[model samples]
Each structure stands twice: as structure tokens, then as C-alpha cells.
Target: MAAGGSRPEPFVVSSVEKVHRVMSWLKEIFGSQSLPPFEKNSETFDLLYTLAEYSEERERDASVLIEDMKERAAKYDAEAEYLQSILTETFDLSPSVLSEEGSAHLKTLVDTAMILDTKDTSLASLFSAISDRSLELLAAETKNKELELNLLEVRNKLTATLALENQLRMDLKKAEKDLEVEEAKAHFRLQNLQFLKHKSEDISIRIKSAEEKLIAIGLQESLMHEPLMKLSQKLAEVQEETVQVKKKLECYFNLPTSLPLARVKIEEAKRELNALEEKVSMRIEEMTDDFLELERL
Candidate 1:
């Protein structure tokens, strides 16, 4: 507000090094041998504070004021020294004269000592304040370092966890792909088995139908063979009848005989037809058995 137009206040950061430096300087400042005051330019460096003990005005050159105070203290010291020298050197004086007439010089000596004592007390109080600030600063620094280390550890753990999570994601994807492949194979195998079963059923049905048809055809052939055998027997009997008629015609008209072996030849033809009929019956039975087997299949 005074010079920088209301800039935000700077944070007060104290350290042991700064505290030690201030203490040493304070010791020098308050020492009896040295000066009580070494103030700085207010325009260059801000004042330590605006306490009533220091001054009423806030904007003033502290260095000049402190120099003036030091000069006054030096003058008081010189007067006190000079008074002691006078007391030691000059002895021809009455007690009333020394007490009354030298009262002003005695007062100067007492005031100087009081100022020195006050400065020593002030320096000691300031040292206590510096020590407190130093310890607080050290504690703050340690806490900050601990917090930083904790954050680093947490960050590292998070990074490792992320890596592990990514690996798990990849593994999950692989498992999904494997599951898909197995599912496809299962589907294919199921369809193939279904097709084979259907094909087997179709083939079995066709074989049964073919066997049934073949058996029916064989049975029909057996029936036709019996009729064919009867026809052959009839033909042989007709031939014998024809020979007898021819012999009768020949004997009635006085012709020669020509029907000697007609009956024997008819009997031989009948035996051959019976043998063919038995063979046909056997073939029909074989076909019927084959048809039953096809039905079982």
C-alpha cells in the first residue's frame, strides 16, 4: 500500500541461518563496546515494524534516526568518562558542591547506563523470537519433504497398477478370442454331426425301399414260373394226345404206327418243370430274407 500499490503481502519465511545471523548482529548492536543502533534506509529496505517503541511515523529513514541515537549515547558515555576523570583528579571540593552543582553530570551517567540495559533486554527478547521462528521453519521443511516422498510413492504404485490393469485387459481380450474360436468350432461340429446323421437316415431308407422292391419282383417271378411250368406240362400232354390221335388215324385207315415213346417223353418234361419250380421258390425265399435285412438296417 505504501509503495508497490497494494501488492499481495510476501510470506514470512524464517530459517536457522537467518536467525543465527540476526542474533550475532543483535549481540554486536547491544554490546557495551559497540553501538546500540545501526538502522537501515527505509526507502531501500522495509522497517522491521511500526511498533510504538521504534517510532510514530511509518515512513522515515531508520538508519539516520538510529545513528542519531548512537551519537547521543556516545556523547553520554564521553560525559560520564569525563566526570569520572574529574572526580579522580580534582579533590578540593565540598560535599554539597559535588552533590548539588554536579547533579546534571551524575544524571547523564545514570541515563546512559539505563539505555544500555534496555538495549540488552531488547536484544535478548529478539533472540528468543528468532529461535522460535527457526524451529517452526525446520518443522515445516521436514513435513514438506515427507509429503513429497509420500506423493512419489503413491504415483509409482499407481503407475504399476495401471500397467497391471493393461496386461489384464490384453489377457481378457485373448480369452474372448479363444472363446469365440471354440464356439465356432463347436457350432461346426454340431452341424456336421447333424448332417451325417441325416445322410445316414436317408441312405438307410433308400436301401430298405430297394430291398422291398427287389423282394416283390422276386416273388412275382416265382408266381410266373409256376404258371410257366404248368404250361410246359400241358404242352407235353398235348403232344402225347397228338401222337395217339395220329396212331388212331393210322390204324383206322390201315397206316403204320408212329407213337412208341410219347408218354415217356411227357414224363421227362414234367420232371424238368418241377425242378425249375423248386429253384424259383428258393430264389424267392432268398430275396424275402434280403428284404427283411434291409428293414432292420
Candidate 2:
């Protein structure tokens, strides 16, 4: 202070100022309601320093008091260590932040971020993609459902068709059975007709042989053919009786007897020389019974 041409004692802390500063510090620390305002800065740190310079605790430098405390240790000297604790609580010096270069890039991106026109462009694209995917899924599901329905329909149709085919097969089997019965009956009748034809042929051969015998016995010329005339008359009577029996059979059976009788001849030149005896006649008894049964039928 003397080298700078200033009075050292006047500039130094005075007794009254020190007292005033200490009072101010006390007010800051304990809150003295009776203390008045100070002339200058009324901060607690300023007051404490001013008071310390004049008090017995004075040292050459504040560093000597601070010593190893470094941060606000002096503020907690007479108190419950509250102010120093608050100072330490407010700061965090842990090295947990990202690198400086990464922070700068992130800051630039944040500062230049785009916040316009995206409502129209980005939302439209997202909505279109979503709609397309939804439509595709819907179509695929519909197709699968339709295929299932078609499969069910096809199965139903197949079942119906099989049922119909089975019914037709049953009908065909019944018809075939009926047809077989009819064929058997028809074949039996055909064999009967052929047998009748063979019997007629045998009867004709026998009659021819008898007529030859009668001719050898002079039955044709002697007595002016009396035996031949009688034989012819008898043949005529037999033919008349056969016609009547045929008519009875035809009338009763509602059939045309002409079909069976058309092959038989009634003319003298054709049928006059009959030979079979009445007892040996094959057609007599059976033909008579057949005519009677036909009339009843």
C-alpha cells in the first residue's frame, strides 16, 4: 500500500468495519433480526473475510486458512456444515458424457432437424404400404375360404353321384335278373317247339311206312278201294275233330290256333292215306287234355 502512494493503515480493515462485517456475517449465518444494513456488499463470504483480517484469526493469505479444504470448507466452520454440503451437492464432475466430437455431431443434427412436409409424404407412404398389405392378406384369406367351400361342394357332388350310380347299379342288377328269368323261360319254350317239330316228323315217317304195308296187302285196289275209302273217311273225321279241338284251344287261350294248324293239310290228296292206329296215336289223349285245359284257362 505505501509503494502505491496510499495510506496502508486506513486501507486495512478497521475495528468498527470488522465489527460491522462480523455482525453482517452473523446475520447471514444465524439471521440477526436486530442488525442494520451494511455500507457495501452484504454477502456472508465478504463479511467473513473482512472480519477475519481484523480478528485474531488473521493470516498472511486466505489460502493458509483454506489449506487442504480447496472448495467451501471455511463456510462450514461454525455451522452444521450445511453451506459447504450444498456447494458440493450442486456440482457433478464424473466423466460419463459422450465424446466431444460425437456431442458436436448430435448437436448439429438436432439444430438442423427437419419438422415439415413429413405429415403429407411419410404418412402417405406408410398408409399406402399398410393398405396394400391388408388387401393382399384379405385376398389370400378369401381365396383359401373359397377353395375350402369348393372342396366341400365337390365332396358333396361326389357323394351324390356315387349314390346315384349305386342306385342305378341296383336297378341294372334287378333288370338283369328279370331278363335272365325271361330268357330261361323263352329257351324252354323254344326247346318245346323243336321237340314238337321232331315228333311231327316221326309221326309222318310212321304213317308212310303203314301206307306202304297197306298197299302190299292190296288195300288200295280190291273191292273198289273199300278199305281205302273207309280209311280216308276216318282220316277226314279225325281232321274235323282236330280242327274243333284247335278252335276250342284258340278261343279259350285268346291265341291264334292257325299258327300251329297251318302246317296240317285237310285235302284228300295230301292227307287221305293215314296209317297210325287210334290206340297208338300220340296226339289223341294229350291233345284232348290240352284243348280242355286251354278252354278252362
lDDT of 2 by residue, 172-244 (tens): 9999999999999999999999999999999888877766775676543322234546655765787777566
lDDT of 1 by residue, 1-297 (tens): 477688778976344434454545455556766644655444212323323214434325676788889997897578656656766678644334677647776566456446444332244644665576779889999999999999999999999999999999999999999999999999999999999999999998886686567567554333243454665576567556655654544433432335446545544555655555565566556656745754564
- Return the clash pairs for model 2, or none: none
What lDDT does model 1 reach? 0.62
Model 2: lDDT to the true structure: 0.59
Model 1 alpha-carbon drift over 4 Å, by segment = 1-128, 219-297
Please name the candidate that would achieve the greatest lDDT relative to the true structure.
1
Candidate models: Cα lDDT each:
0.62, 0.59
In the order shown, what is each candidate's alpha-carbon RMSD?
28.5, 36.9
